[model samples]
Structure formats: structure tokens, C-alpha cells
Target: PTTTQAGRAKPNILVTGTPGTGKTTTSSLLAEATQLRHINVGDLVKEKGLHDGWDEELQCHILNEDLVCDELEDMMEEGGNIVDYHGCDFFPERWFDCVVVLQTDNSILYDRLSSRGYTGSKLTNNIECEIFQVLLEEAKASYREDIVMALQSDSLDDISRNLSTLTGWVNNWILDRSS
Candidate 1:
């Protein structure tokens, strides 16, 4: 059953992109504006030990996808979740009403990643991911095309625009649910 069918008044949104693309910032702001719950998957993975182990080369955790899904299943069903993560393919397609894949220019992304101390293969791999639009492809593959969108996050203005756009979408969703 859908969240609406389950009597949930709000929708679940997935905010995904390569590192430094502002998934957390966007999700947090969106959640604040809409009074939705923001679940930063990276932080949840770390805090809840929802991963097999850390990948030293990647300088990140090896996410246990099944565990992540299991942990989020209930909340997702109840709706009103803003899930922020880099990877998207592993999540259940039914979990999100909207899947937003944030895209950033290579040079801008490079600077952001570099400032975050991302170097060597970790940095290169992420830059290449953005260059190739890997996350957008993953989201499209994992969800219905109509529900997935790629949004720019190259500058503060872009983020502001995205926030406004998504907030309006949320309002429309609520109205749709009511009707």
C-alpha cells in the first residue's frame, strides 16, 4: 500500500548525489521547511553500525544495504522521510514519492571535494561519478522515471532554487493526497 493508503499525510523524498553535492544540506533544509524527518543515511550507517565494515580505500563505510532497508522500512511506510545518501540503487523503489539526484559542475565539485580533504582515488572516483552522472542513472534505474529528477547544485543560488522548487512540489503532494 502507498503512504496515502496507509493514512500518512506526507511523502517520502530521497535526496541523492555524489559527495559534496549538498545532499545533506538540501535534505536538512527541505526537512526543516516541510517539517519532515531528515535521515542522513551516512550518519545513520555510522551511528547504528548498519554496515559490514569501513572501506579504507574509499575512506567510507561499506553500507549493508539490506540492513539499511530493514531499518528504514517502517519509517518509509509511514512516510514524511527525507533520506539523504550518495548511493540510491539499493533502496526499495516504493520508499520514495520523489527521488532527487543533485548534479554539480565538475570544477565546482572538484573544489568542494578537495576542500573536504578528499584526495587520490576517493576524490577521483567521486569526480568521475559526477562527471558520468552515475547517481542520476542509478536513481532512474531504481525508481519510476516520472518520480525521479536531476537538479543542479552548482551554487548557493541553485540550492535556493531547488529548495523552492521542492517545497512547492511537497505542497502539491499534500494537496494531491487530500484530494
Candidate 2:
């Protein structure tokens, strides 16, 4: 989609939530349907070696927030990128036209995480984070309330509904900006 303002031809969408909340899944479908580039932050961190070092305990890399933003700033400004990550506060608030935080029921989340082999502290921390709606609250705090929304990802039906609703919204945004 093209924007009225030159050099702003696309919209940046951030799809974020606690782990196992389906941010990647939703963003993937959205990208396919909307023709946006899907950038999984985790994959980016790994590919670009943007991480500081490995976290043996958490079993994940320690990402450098500054480096990540620097590396992605250009694409973000050019727009039409759907960013999928569990955390959002570190990203510049202005980078996104919309921030979607997917939510899942605790039991459903537990099952999903368990199936992924998340155990003990890691699993518990993630579940607690979901229960507390940390990602949703963070999105709201980082961006205008109108631009940040909490979407349910509890089932396939919910995912379908979300995709339809969000695709419509994206279309409207493009039309509005272009006009």
C-alpha cells in the first residue's frame, strides 16, 4: 500500500505476546494475506548475531535492544513489515501503525507450552506473564491506546476472526493514508 506522504509507503505492524501466544503464527498468516514482510525478531537476533551472548539458564540468547532497533530501523521506516516478538517495549513506539497483542487462555497456553517442552521456571514465568497480561499492558503503555489492541488467540476460529478483522483494518489504514 502507498501512503500520501512520500517515503512512507507502508505500515509497520507489531504482533507481540507472551511466548506460545501465537504471535508468529498470526503474523505469518497476516503477512501472507496482506503482502507484508514478516520479520521474526528471534530469528533476526540469531541471524544477524545481534545478541550479546547466550543465556544458559533461560536457554535463549540475550538480545541487545539497541542493536536490534538499529539493524531494523530502515525496514521499519519503509513500512509494510510485520514484526513478531514476545517483547515490545524496547521498540520505538512510532515504528508501528498498529500493535497487536495476542492473548490465550491460561490452560490452553499451558498445553501449548508444555507440548513445546517448556518446563519449570521458564514455563511458569511465561504462564504468569500471560496471566498478568504483561504484553497487552506493555503495548498500551508504549503506544496510543487506539493503536494497540489485545486479540484473543485461544483457538483456530479466533485466529481466523483476528486475521479477517486485522486485514480489514490494514486495508483501511492504507486507504486512509493514501487519500
Candidate 3:
């Protein structure tokens, strides 16, 4: 199927959520399924030397936590891109055709964060971010309600289904936009 904005040209889809909720993984899957370029904001920041000297603490807490729209607008140009990041409030809603916010249970989130080798305060903030719905609320507040899609990633199947559903949605959006 085609996307709604296909006639206008391609559009971006942001896959966002807390760290342990599988934003990157789900975005990767959606990218592959939709044949869209995967622009991982976290990785792009590192690649562009935006965080060259920054340590993990500064990366997560300072830069990422307080991101702004100008930063995102600079990273992505007009076209279809699958942006995977933990935050979504920065980018303009007009630039994004859709957003998928992944969610997970606290126990599952804690296990995922702990297994990542994060310790002390770094881990603490992330856990709190997950528990507090920081990304979710941010997305909700930043965009129209219909533009955001929430998915719960409780297991492998959940991730797979979310990816598949997102792919289908993108396809439908494409078709609708073209027709």
C-alpha cells in the first residue's frame, strides 16, 4: 500500500519511547519492512560528532533529556525517514506523518535496563524515565492525538506485532495519500 503523504512526497515516522521499550529495535524492523531509511537520532548525534566529547551521563541526561526541535530539524530533511529515539517532543508535527510510542511493563523495563550494564545514577534516571512516562507524555503534548500510536512491548511477539502493524499502517498511509 501507499502512504497518505506519498503524493506530497515521503514523510517521516518517529518510533519513540523510553530506553528499554525497544524504540530502536521496533524502528529498525519498521524501516526494513517499509524500506525507509533508519535515522537513529542517538547514533546520528554520535556520528555527526555532536557528542564527541560527551560521556554517557551527559549524553542521556543533558543532551538527550533536553533536546529541542532545531536539533531534530537539522538532522532530518524532507523525505521518508524512520527516526528512532527516546524523545519526540522536539520535532515539528508537520515533519512527522506518524509516531509509534513503545511501552513495557516496569519489571521488564528494569530487567532490560539493568542488563544493559547501566549502574548507579545513570540507570536510576532511565528507570525513572520509563516509570514516569516521560516520552509518552511528551509525545502526547507535542502532537495531535491521532498522529501518535502507542504499542506495548511486553515480549518478542509484541515487538513483532507492533512492527508489523506499523508497517501496515505506513503502507495504508502511503496508499491513502496517493489515492
TM-score of each: 0.95, 0.95, 0.84
- Considering summed lDDT, which 10 consecutive residues are worst modelled in model 3? 59-68
Clashes of 3: 8
Query: Which scores better on TM-score, 1 or 3?
Result: 1
lDDT of 3 at 23: 81
For model 3 the local lDDT of residue 9 reads 53
What TM-score, to 2 decimals, does candidate 1 have? 0.95
lDDT of 2 by residue, 94-176 (tens): 78888999999999999999999999999999999999999998998889999888899999999999999999998988887
For model 3, the superposed segments whose C-alpha errors exceed 4 Å read 1-7, 51-77
**C-alpha lDDT of all candidate models, in order:** 0.91, 0.91, 0.76
**Model 1 ranges with Cα > 4 A deviation:** 1-7
The runs of at least 3 residues in candidate 2 whose Cα sits more than 4 Å from the true structure, single-residue gaps closed, are 1-7
**Predicted candidate 1: what Cα RMSD to the true structure?**
1.5
lDDT of 1 by residue, 23-62 (tens): 9999999998999999999999999999999888777899
Per-model C-alpha RMSD? 1.5, 2.7, 4.2
Candidate 3 lDDT by residue in tens digits, 44-158 = 6765545425565534424443343455553345567888878777676667878788888988888898899877887778878878888889998998889888889989999
